[model samples]
Target: IDRLAPSVVTAALDAAGQGTAETRYLVAGAGTMASLAVRTLVERGVAPERIMLTNRTYQRAAEFVATFGVGAVRWESLDVELQAADVLISCTGATGVVFDRDRIARATQDGRPLTLVDLALPRDIAADVTSLPNATLIDMQVLAERAADSEVVSDVAAVRAIVDGEVGTFLAAKSASRVTPTVVALRGMAVEIVQSETERLEARLGDLSDVQRAEIRRALRRVSDKLLHQPTVRVQQLVDGPAGLTYADALADLFALDPSAVDRVSAVGEGATND
Candidate 1:
């Protein structure tokens, strides 16, 4: 999704030509999504110094500049950036409109055409923003619809297939992940039993040969793997099917496992890997 968004942003810039070194851009958010958008613009040939970032939180603006190696200002200082910017991309997750008609009109009164791209879910740019002279507002839904219409029929079909395949893969991976903790716990129990029995036998026999102990350990591990094999495969198959989520929930419930524990594990794993 991150990759796709940047590609889309790049294409938009190519079409709009508003992020060149000569053209200034303002990104009005320092969140992860906004950072990505800004990063994309910079990577696509917009000079870092030419781009200005503004976030509601001063610290967030600072953090964004530090993280993405860009120039940023607090929202309170937006007017300075607004006067010079040719393009504005707003990805702030604000509940209400961040830019109203009056604010946009004020920016345009300075004599520069303003293009605003609002990527917020509830919309950061008010509906009246576009009504202002020299102001053009583009939203995600509009861009998505445009992309959808412009997409080739075959390409659209291919994308749908890819989405379905990816959805299936994610579900299967999730389902497999769901059972992992239970499997680990069960294996831990088995290993404990084996160790206890080995200790008892060693005590009774005075001392068992090292080779015999090693063989017993390997055998116990093999037995555990064999016991777990079918269920693991079945669980993965269930995850690939239509009832995958339901089956995963049932399995987790049946094993008395915490679903949130699985989610936490997945989140940790994702954090560990850069992707």
Candidate 2:
């Protein structure tokens, strides 16, 4: 979901010929949505030096510049950046308009074409910004209308299908993570049992060779894998079903496994895999 929205924004920018050298892009937020927009712009061959970022929090704006900066200007001076920018993608979560008629007028006075994208729910750019000469405001509602008009019926359906598939994939991944702790706990129990039995057998058999120890380990591993195979597959299948998390929780509780452990394991796995 995070990745998809930015690609959409990039496609829009590419369609508008904003991915070129002559365009100067300014993004006014440091949040996830804004970050994604910035990332998209940078990825689609927009020169970093031609970009400027301004956030309410100076530190956040600086951090954004540091991470995605490349050639981006970390504007401690917001007004200066706004005045100089040719294209502005405003995704700020402000309650009121961040850029008004005066700002729009000033930006347009520079004689550069300005494309303002107000992606916020309660639009960050004032309605009057569009009235200014050379300033074109493209808000979310307008973008939606444009999309509906321009998109082919089949392409729209394809996008919807992609979104649905992504939603399902995310839910399945979450559900699979939910049951992973229980599986781990079960495997731990099996290993403990094996170790205890091995210790008991060691006393009876007296000193066993390294080869015997290796064979025992292999046998235990095979047994554990065989024991877990069916339940593991079942859990994976359940991930695609409704109430999968609930079923996973029930299974965990029934097995006396800790529910929080599932989240911990999932977090660790996600971190490890960079997902």
Candidate 3:
């Protein structure tokens, strides 16, 4: 992401009708994209003082300066920084408009053309600013479409594929774990019935010897175990495959299992994996 910012600045400069050597950059956020944009500019040989970095809070801008050497970080006099900039990238997460029409109008009044890129979701820069005489506005949608049309840059596509694969595996494991509680609950129910039936038989046949009662109880347990063996093993096997989650969900619904118990089991599994 940092590697693309210099080329973006170059394009933004050309669109604003500004010369390369004379350009001054203003970064209007301290987030990932904003920091990457600053790093990109500096790596391309722009002087630190020539880059103006600002955040919503002064401390965040200061934190950037501490981490990435010194730069023109400002929390106040935003208009002055905007006025001097040939290109500005706004990547703040603010919900409402940061740069409205009137602010852009006042900043660009000095006859210098300005290029503004809005990287926020709801947009930090207003769309109406495009109507201003020599000003240019670039939003996230334009940049994304342009990026999609371009060829893969330096094995980035391969890296993205790897990340996607890792995410899929993680999701599969999480889905498989959902059946754990249901399996445990089913076995517990089986054991409870076995104990209850054993007691009833002992009470009805009161004169039976202890050894015969013990053997009969063992036989009952074996029967229950045999009945469950195939299903439990099959469920485990099915849970590892792509269709695993569906089978797990079906098992829970068919058994009338407690949703809260399933969720608690899943949460515990997630926390253990996280650790």
Candidate 3 lowest-lDDT run of ten: 151-160
Model 3 lDDT tens row, 1-275: 44554455444333444337767888898887777667766666777777778887888888777766646456577888888888888878675799999999999998788888776555799999999996888875455455543542332444345546866787776765766766776777789889999999999989999899999899999999999788777887888777786887787787677777677776877798799
- TM per prediction: 0.51, 0.50, 0.49
Clashes of 1: 0
lDDT of 1 by residue, 1-275 (tens): 44355545654554455444577888888776687777787667677777778888888888867776778787788977787889888878775788888888888996778888876655788887767779877765555556744453344345446656866776567666655554454445556777887677767877678998788778877876787677656766776567765765676666566556666665766676556
Q: Write one digit per residue (lDDT tens) for candidate 2, span 1-275.
A: 44345645654564455445777888888787788877887777787777788877767777876898633445457677777777888877775788888978876797777888876545688887767779887765555556644543344345557656866776667767766766676666677878887777777888899899778778877887897788767876785678776767676766676556666776787798796
Q: Report how far off residue 145 is in candidate 3 (Å).
A: 4.0
RMSD of 1: 8.6
| Cα-based lDDT at residue 172, candidate 3 | 72
* Candidate 2 lDDT trough over 10 residues, lowest sum: 148-157
Clashing pairs in 2: 48-71
How many pairs of residues in model 2 come into backbone collision? 1
> After superposition on all CA atoms, what RMSD does each candidate show versus the true structure?
8.6, 9.7, 8.5
Model 3 stretches with alpha carbons more than 4 Å out: 1-19, 148-275
